[model samples]
Target: MKNKLSKLYKIFLAVGMVFSMCFNTLGMSVVNAYDPSVPKEFTRVKNIKYPEWWGRKIPSIASWSTYSCKYDGKWAFCLEAEKKTPASGKYPAQVIENNENVRKLLYYGFGGPAAYGEFAADADLKTAICPDDPLTNDDIKYLLTHIFLSGAYSGQWKGFDENLFNQTFGSNYGTNIMNIYRRIISLPDPGNGVSWEGNKSGNRALFKASYDKTNKQQVTNTVKLNGASSAEVNIPLASNVTIHIAGTSATQTGGTAKVYGGQSFYFTAPCQNSPSNFVSDNICGNGCERFTALAIHDGGAGTQAQGTWNMDPDDARLYLNIE
Candidate 1:
């Protein structure tokens, strides 16, 4: 169920700022400390590992459908009126900047470095594609889906998840968001013992961690949850897995969930946030629009098995189903 927006939430909406995020009951806050010396340009982002297939071929946009973005740049498709509002723009640039999948879509849409005849190392797609205005959730949805459809049409996204796309989008332009999701997960295994992929179904965002026994077992990662209402973490293997939701400073509306290797744990909003509702749902007392950092791992049992969590975005670990 949706929670009422508090007055403070409305105020933050007006000024375009995030309220200070406090920890949940778990008493932990995952902070991205800002560094002033690093250049703000997209090219300056360091240590990102793009999929091997990136920049391999530049997609032809000649036949791709187009739309006029309010920011003066032309995008691939137009969004429904409700989703194109200025409010949508408030959904955090910091989140998008840190996402590897979003970055890939950006570079690919700009025709890759090869298209410019410059070496891959020198290509700066951000300067060319990232708009000066703050990016809205819809802006991301439009761009990613547009590029995805064009790529699919051009036969670039081979073995595409047709059923998944049809089930999620199903002849609706407004819902054609995050088409890059399935593609990202489907990429060749990262060979890291565990591979991560995420998808969206209705109101829930689904996350899958596939483990390869040859590499390693029991992978743990920090996950950031955006707009979550509730979540379910399922550890199908016979190991002890623990999921913790770090709480807010004032309320401590956070806790932990655990499953004995073959069970699932679930919780609701405030103590939760659901994927699609991140931008619209406001439960944080300071009107911060609560984003949770979830830490998940099998307590070093070294079990080679798959795990699933229905949640939202960060790095490549989460995919925000910002419908």
Candidate 2:
């Protein structure tokens, strides 16, 4: 549900980092490794098709909203922005726009020089806006797609179901912090026909992808849960999805639905290929697998069932209800 924090994503996804991540109770970044032989930046991350988007931060302006279901809920935010076009339409914009490769980064989370109609050239980066620049769209698109290597804890993020996480963190997990981000280093995809994206090399890396905010190009969405699962979610290209908690969702705590809290988790829903709004009611209807998974007891504070999110300042809860 949260993608902007690209750097933070690497920590949660890469099982190895679970052992080396230098973090505090607050989940902030701390320098853990000090090997000069290793490059501060990633060179060749494995698993992912293009090891370009390994360690980069993508910027976004999300409109905030909240929703909840019985026993679990969500209080996450999202951004639906269009290409911010400048009058010039030359140089970076035109250069990036003219390059069909540039549009690839805008569509999918990953972008490279030629994949998906996007491109990034290797220049001296004399005026490059990167990592976290707050000016200019040129810097915005270029920096957003290029993933950079990071140590760990620089940001907050959700950790998913990986054995490395449990062995390394030792019962400490959760994405309850704000300003969280995820960066990809080297994580390998599964060797199945499903076609997954990952880079599992020992170093952090980034790809050269760009997006012309000026074009306002949109990303399409779709959703489909395989086999018999508790729930199904659908993501949209733009913004207009909502998850309601008070309506018809809750936990055995029947008193009233409250979000369950738990460790960091990943939720991936397909982007809609056509124009249609997918919706869900009640928690996953069945033996309660859905409720058990997202119950606040796990530290999530919201049931993954109803797609509701209830986050307050005291604690950061991500009620990511999409698809």
Candidate 3:
């Protein structure tokens, strides 16, 4: 009985050794074995390859796909997919191919100087053929501080998150983003404010103005004059208002003209030789100069006239100065 028991013990020990060899050689334990049948959220990219010049690894997921990547030593996920997924409609790509900014990001994050030539070539190709595929906002924030604001791609990567880039590097980068914002604000949008249609030749004018909540200012008041009859416009009280009058031949004439109020105002009128004249009108007190009426003479000549009067602050209506 003792001999039989010893043999059984040896056999069990040999089985244990075989199991240990399998675990050590394969680098996998039974508990950690991979199962092909299980669903996976992401899979490693294989077979397809990118050129060395591409700078960064082409994401393993398909185009328009969503996945996570290590950014700044942390896992960062794409805000949108490269294309439309069932979960999301036509989403933007996380990393655009051949993008100079993206290439710079890769270089600063992982690549080296040897990849610069490839980055430039790929960027040119992508610019000519690809649509804008911007990075996620969070990703942009990370890179803006770590890569862009650090001056890693100063002259090379022009692409940046305007708001974030401006906010982060405005002091050091010379507030270029603020300048861009100012330019955008200065652009005129004719259709944006209150507008009117009237006949200038007929002495008739239509005017409209509304409060602009976004700018915390009065919307631009516009007058369109056509040859018809005498007309007038009354707008609500506003500060530093700008009135634009346009037509073939229009003129300002006499009536209850109020040029002065809380702040100065502007007038754009037609002149004989010049395209138009811009006049600044100020209001000092109750007694202020006012342009009452605009009239077109018998021969289609435009005339602008002004008179002095004390405008009551209680008055809710403001007159139009158009010629």
Per candidate, the number of residue pairs that clash is: 12, 92, 22
- Supply the TM-score for candidate 3: 0.16
- Residues 1-323 of candidate 3 have per-residue lDDT tens digits of 01122455568658968987888899974331222122223221112211222212223312222222322222222211221112211111122222233233333221211123212323232332122434433322232222231232223222333454445434433245334223322432111111224321112232323345665443334444211121223332222233423332322322223322212222332221212212113212222212111111112123111000111222212223222
lDDT of each: 0.28, 0.22, 0.27
Candidate 3 C-alpha RMSD relative to the actual structure: 36.6
**Best by lDDT, which number?**
1
- Residue 240 error, candidate 1, Å: 42
The lDDT-based order of candidates, best leading, equals 1, 3, 2
lDDT tens per residue, model 2, 132-250:
33333323223233221011211111222234333433442212111111312122111101110122122111111122255432222221222222222222222322222223342
Per-model TM-score versus the true fold:
0.18, 0.15, 0.16
lDDT of 1 by residue, 124-233 (tens): 32332333434433433444444453343233432233454455335632233233344443432211111213244322343323332554432222234332122223
Between candidates 1 and 2, the one scoring higher on lDDT is 1
